[model samples]
Target: MADIIIIGGGIIGLSSAYYLSKQGHQITVIDKGDLTDNCSFGNAGMIVPSHFVPLAAPGMIRQGIRWMFDSKSPFYVKPSLGGGLPAWGLTFLKKSTQRHVEESALPLRDLSLLSKQLFQDLAKEPDFDFELRNNGILAFYKTEKAAEEEAHLAKRAIELGLDMAVLSKAECEALQPKLKLDVLGAVHYRCDAHLYPVKLMQALIKYLEQKGVKIVRNQEVTRMTTNGSQISSVFTGTKEWKADQYILATGSWSPAVAKLLGLNISLMPGKGYSFMEDEPQQRMSIPALLCEARVAITPMNGQIRYGGTMEIAKINSQVNMNRVEGIVASVPKYFPDLTPAVPALKDIWYGFRPSSPDGLPYIGRSPKLNNLVVATGHGMMGLSLGPATGLLVSQLVSGQRPEIDIQAFLPQR
Candidate 1:
């Protein structure tokens, strides 16, 4: 069995450990913080095969620039003259083309569908049960402008062989007769699914432990000691850990870790926030995206979670109350029956999504190192893409071909 050390204990790291351990590899996971809190918690727990388009597609530059001024807008970018963001900006602009989006769609669709199936299989395992639902996701739009855009995207999705339906206002109301929606129309992706993220994380971690994977929390990798073509060992916060193969699954901090080994990856942290209501005044039967506001609403574990706002900024958790309020403000406009009470800054949960310049994940072995693999930069789709990434890492380690073509997700690209 190979000795593998996985850096970062987020969903990607833990999932990698699970798959590797299952294949009889002696696994060790190192994390910078205690495993109690992580990027996996408090996220909109949806498995979306419907999201085939990359975030850096055409017209995003205009929208991101437009939203740059509006604090309440769904997307924003904090200007930074340093930290290689300018270079990333240029690359992002170049990748925001029809060619990029078309090239990205099929691979992304394959990955999400595979991960969704893996999640289903994971649910059937003993003690791994959580709130797994096939209730699907509704992308509801209130504005005619947004509705037209969604309709175009839905047409593209249908052409791409995705299972979806374009529902009029009355059809939408028919599906959700309980709650009143203030939307012109909705695009229903029937292949999507949702689950309780916290439960999934807990179950996966527990299963890994039971299967002899060593998980060491609060141990951060500070540096790497490498040979000519392979990483010999990694220096962490308290000690140096060596392994035959290493997987760098650190979420938002992937680029920083890659730089330690002289690897170039264009990654930025996109901060997002969410507030949970103990008992939703208006509980949604299915998860829905307020398309105009980019706010995500999910019914999970006796509570409803409203999450939105992609703030591309530096690495910190200083809560922007305006952004949180913006999410709360958009809810009532979309779902009239649900007037949510805003929570204090302390009560809200926020985390950084590892965003790539082209909105595609980095998943493969580092070109410079023989035994190092990079499995990060998933952005908003990290939760949806975790298991497939793990399975791919395991396949790479075992010298077996991956099920999906991974050329699009090569770390160097």
Candidate 2:
């Protein structure tokens, strides 16, 4: 059996460890933090098979430029010439064509469908009881423009063999009878699902530890020693750890870790914010995505978690209150009564999504290092796509064929 070392303790790393250990491989997971703080948590907890479209799609540049002027806009890219942003921006512009979107649809759909099935399977496991709900998500639109956009997307989804239906305001209200909606119309993506991310991550860590996987928390990889093309050892301060194979699943910090191994990947940290509030009434059973505002509100863990905004900037600790306010302001527009107050700074949680320029994740073997697997750049869908990525990583490590064609997710592409 190969001894494998996985860097990063988020959903991807832990999921990889879970599958790799199931194959009877000796596994070790090392994380820079105590595992509680990562992008895997503080997310919208959406398992979206409906999201086949990548971020780098047509008309995004026009919309992004419009949003740039508004402080409370859902998407923002901080101006910077340093640290790969310029080149990433150029590639993003190049890939934002209709041809790119058309080409990316099938692979993304397949990956999402695979991950949704895997999530269903994982929920059935004895050790897991994370609130895995398959109630689907509602994409609510308030404007005619947004309604047209969603209708077009729903049509594409239906053509690709996905279950989606366009709903009127009355139909949307019937589905969500407990709350009032001011939307013009909505699209019910029957293919999507949701879960509590904290519970999922906790269950994975607990199960892996019980199965004898070494989890070294609060240990950051400071340096690496490589022998030719293979990684000889990894160092965290004075201690050294070695394994037969290595997996780099670090989320937003992947580029920095790859740099240590003389590899460069085009990735930017798209920071997002989330805050939870008590919803004892459980008024919203189905998760709702505000079409124009780009906010996501989901009923999870006896509370409603409101999350949104994509700030493409350097990773930092300061919380942008304007972004959080943007999420809060959008909620009342859709659900007139569901007004959530601006959460205090301490309660607000922000995490960076490792976004690729082409709006697709990088999940494949490194061409430069035979023993290494690169699995990051999942962007906002990291949690939704975690299990599929982990399963593919296991298959890649075992020299078996991947379940899906990973040509679109090549790291060097």
Candidate 3:
């Protein structure tokens, strides 16, 4: 078996290590932070096959422009020309076409389904128990415009062989009998599932350690040495680690990491925020996605995690209270009894999602470096797509055929 070194300790990196070690490969996962929290932990924790629509879909540019004016908007791009934002924006504009959306649906659906199945399989293992629930998610809409859009999307999902149904407000109430819904209608995405992300991350770390995988924390990759067209070794200040193969699974930091090797990858860090609250009553059974608000509410670890907003900009440590307020404000408008207060700054959690211009993830082998594989650029779907990407990464490293055709997720695309 080959010795593999994976950079980034988030869900994608750890998942890659998990699968690689399972195949008898010597794996070492290195991260800049302790393996405690990340985008993988503080997310909505929904495994959604229902989310086939890419972020760069039609009408997004028009909507994004309007949202730019509001500090509390669900989507905001901090005005800046630096950090390659202008080029990424232009490519995003170019890809926000109906043809792109139509072309992306099948591949996104197939990838999500594969990941969902893999999660189910993992949950059955004795060492893994992350509260994997297959009850599906509810997309609640409060306005007529949102209702019509959701209906159209549901119809398209059904056409793609995904299980979805349009439900009236009464039908929605039937699903969550304990809580009162103040919405016009909802789309029941029965193909989706939910899990506790923190537990999931912890379980993977524990299981990998038991199986003899080395997880190195607080080690940031500084440089890489190349022999011909292949990567020979990676440096993280104190250590020079050599491996037969290297995988770049860093999330939002991928662009900077790729730049170390003189490669240009068009990606931006889309920062998002989330906070959890005690839900002793457990009023919410199925996870809810507010259609117009773009907020996600899910019950995880006996608490409710309210998360939303996609702030595309450079990575920083500032907490935008307005965005968190927007998430809190939208919850009551949908579920009247489920009003969450704006969390304190200390209670808030934020993570940067590595987003690509075309909205699909960057997977598969790098064209310039034969020994390097790229697996970042998952955006909001990073947690949802983790296992499938990891499995595919292992397959690529082993010189075996991937389970699905990954042409749509090529890194150099």
TM-score of each: 0.98, 0.99, 0.99
Kindly give the stretch of ten consecutive residues in candidate 3 with the minimal lDDT sum: 330-339
RMSD of each: 1.1, 0.7, 0.7
Off by over 4 Å in 1: 280-282
How many collisions per candidate?
A: 0, 0, 0
Poorest lDDT segment (10 consecutive residues) of candidate 2: 174-183
lDDT of 1 by residue, 1-413 (tens): 89999999999999899889889999999999887778788799989999999988999998888888887888988889977689888889999999999999999999999999999999898998889999899999988899889889889988988888899989988888888988898999898999999999999889999998999988878889899999999997657889999999999988888889988778889999998887545457889999988999999998999899888888986988888889999998988878778898778999999999999999998888989989999999898999999999999988999989999999877
In order, what lDDT does every prediction score? Answer: 0.90, 0.94, 0.93
What ranges in model 2 sit over 4 Å off? none
Candidate 1 has an lDDT of 0.90
Comparing 2 and 3 by lDDT, which wins? 2
Candidates in descending lDDT order: 2, 3, 1
Report the C-alpha lDDT of model 2 over 6-106, residue by residue, as the tens digit: 99999999989989999999999999999997999899999998988899998999999999999999999999998889999999999999999999999
Which residue pairs does candidate 3 place in steric collision?
A: none
lDDT (Cα, 0-100) at 148 in candidate 1: 89
| Model 2 TM-score, 2 decimals | 0.99
